[model samples]
Target: MTSRDTLAPVFRDVRAVVFDTDGVITDSARVHAAAWKTAFDAHLRAHPPRDPRLRRPFDVRDDYLRHVDGKSRLDGAAAFLRARGLDTPEETVRAVAADKERLFTERLRAHGVDAYPGTVRLVRTLRRAGIPRAAASASRHAGELLARAGVLDLFDVLVDGGEAARLGLPGKPRPDLFLEAARRLGVPAPRAAVVEDALAGVEAGRRGGFALVIGVDRTGVPDTRQRLLRHGADIVVCDLGELVVRGEPK
Candidate 1:
């Protein structure tokens, strides 16, 4: 375990924390990646790329991390399509995004997801310590996902994709969502910490000037850890349980 004093010194000054929902809190990122693969694969089959190098199918790991993860459905679709050198008209993007949404919803309804035990423990610890917590996600289904995982009540606030759109907040890699979550928690951005599993999310936390940007690397890949650090994560851990608050129960 990484003691707060050693690994998370900023926690002493952190007034609140904002977490990214999909991969950080709940195990739903893989579901989203699978859905994206199905949608993108179908689209690719119908419209193969002329370039041989770009003709390969979407890689759930690399493709999702680079182009789709932590982005809104439409934004993710457009980004992946562009990366594959496919035409990215608004209509095409929407069509692919819609297909992903349908597929994701079906999978979610069929097999509900669970919250990460470590994350739940961390959230509970923070709550017991009187620190406010917020869950922020690019997915509009964030709330539903949390509710299904039985961890929605753990957060004091949630800034989801629906709320972001309603407030005209831009997606990840922008500080809007994390900033809003901090704002709702009644804490200044510089006094709050942001926990995320996505590169874009860590970048947003850094751009927001949050006190700490903790990256959750569930993949356990050395390259992923380095990438997270390069993306502005102050520290990276494989699981939330590794983070131990000073004078707090293990």
Candidate 2:
């Protein structure tokens, strides 16, 4: 049984939680980063940087965190290209994004994703406690990935890329996606919590006025926990398992 000593403090008033799909719940964030590296590196090699100073390969950690993580494919591609001083045409952006999509899909198919045991434990605890929960992401493949992980049924609501497009909601760092998920859960933003690993996602939760924003730092990167806090997370945890409460619910 899980110990209650490390239970997440936000659950005291947080009636619902909206979790980001990637690093927070599943172990697929690294895969996505790898795919991004492959696509971006190929593009960079084909169109070498005009400035030698900027003639560097795509950095999976720094570059992904800065421009790709938690963003739409096209947005990521455009941001990365601009960072490399190569803000090409819309067609070029679309092509790059398409290549990334293909690469990610192939990787996902070859090696399916797995839900983090810590996350699964916390989610089951939330379910047993009757706390409403939702899963939200900017990626169109969010739903597919969740389904493949076999944890799709754990969420009461899902506001993935499809729903965002249907509602024309803006992406993260803008609170629209999280706000929408909270609305669907019939809970006010201040009554819900957001669990995210992306800096943009934490900022979005803060902007949305959520009760608490928990940042999951799976990467164990230096200063990452502090970065998440600086970005807007009320508290940072290394794993969702830290939030699991054993024994009976109060």
Candidate 3:
């Protein structure tokens, strides 16, 4: 059994901490938002606003925050179009999503994903202290991103969308993917910690009853933190590296 005494602060019996990939570890949320906007705008522009262009195609800030983020590509595509009251064909939406993914992928091949230095430092601290760690992401490309970041070897377990779908694991806002990672890492739900930035991911952590749910408010906004708390994060931090103490051990 895990000992509460050792992991009782912001974390519980959590021997291994699980994190979301895109926003938590990497600085890719903005990239994703830009890609989504480019894809959705072209599609919506052609259709035009129902009310004489009263509204622009899509507001990346509000629209990304509301419908597309942290969701599966296909789901996101369908959702954005639905909100615009312009029902696009399934094939059309899928193609749009694929194009968006390609945009992201092209950017990746050119510049590649990079993990936050703070995240890297914190991971090292945890590893040095003998606390196992894992990662989970809604992206099927999570593995590829991690590889490009040169940190794929760090996590003991990884659960990405590709594996989740194959295993019949539910997506975010449901605890399945997080719980599945916990299972693979040999940790019980009550003894694990989950770290995420996405609203859906935080909600999933809440549903799973993880020992601790740490929300990363990278956007540095009160509303963002509030949203994370609404989904039930135990603690929210603007920076993950701040969690590391120079000479402390978990």
TM-score on alpha carbons, each prediction: 0.94, 0.94, 0.89
What tens-digit string does per-residue lDDT give for candidate 2 at 81-144? 9999985799999999999889999999999999999999898888877899999999888889
Model 1, 96-153: lDDT tens digits are 9999999999999999999999888788878877899999998989999999999999
Colliding residue pairs in candidate 1? none
Write candidate 3's Cα lDDT for 67-165 as tens digits: 776777887888778777776798888988998999888787888878998788788767766888888987888998889888988899899989988
lDDT of each: 0.91, 0.89, 0.80
Which pairs, if any, clash in model 3?
none
On TM-score, the stronger of 1 and 3 is 1
| Sliding window of 10 residues with minimal summed lDDT for model 2 | 1-10
TM-score of 1: 0.94
The C-alpha RMSD in Å for every predicted model, in order, reads 3.0, 2.2, 4.3
Cα deviation of 133 in candidate 3 (Å)?
1.1
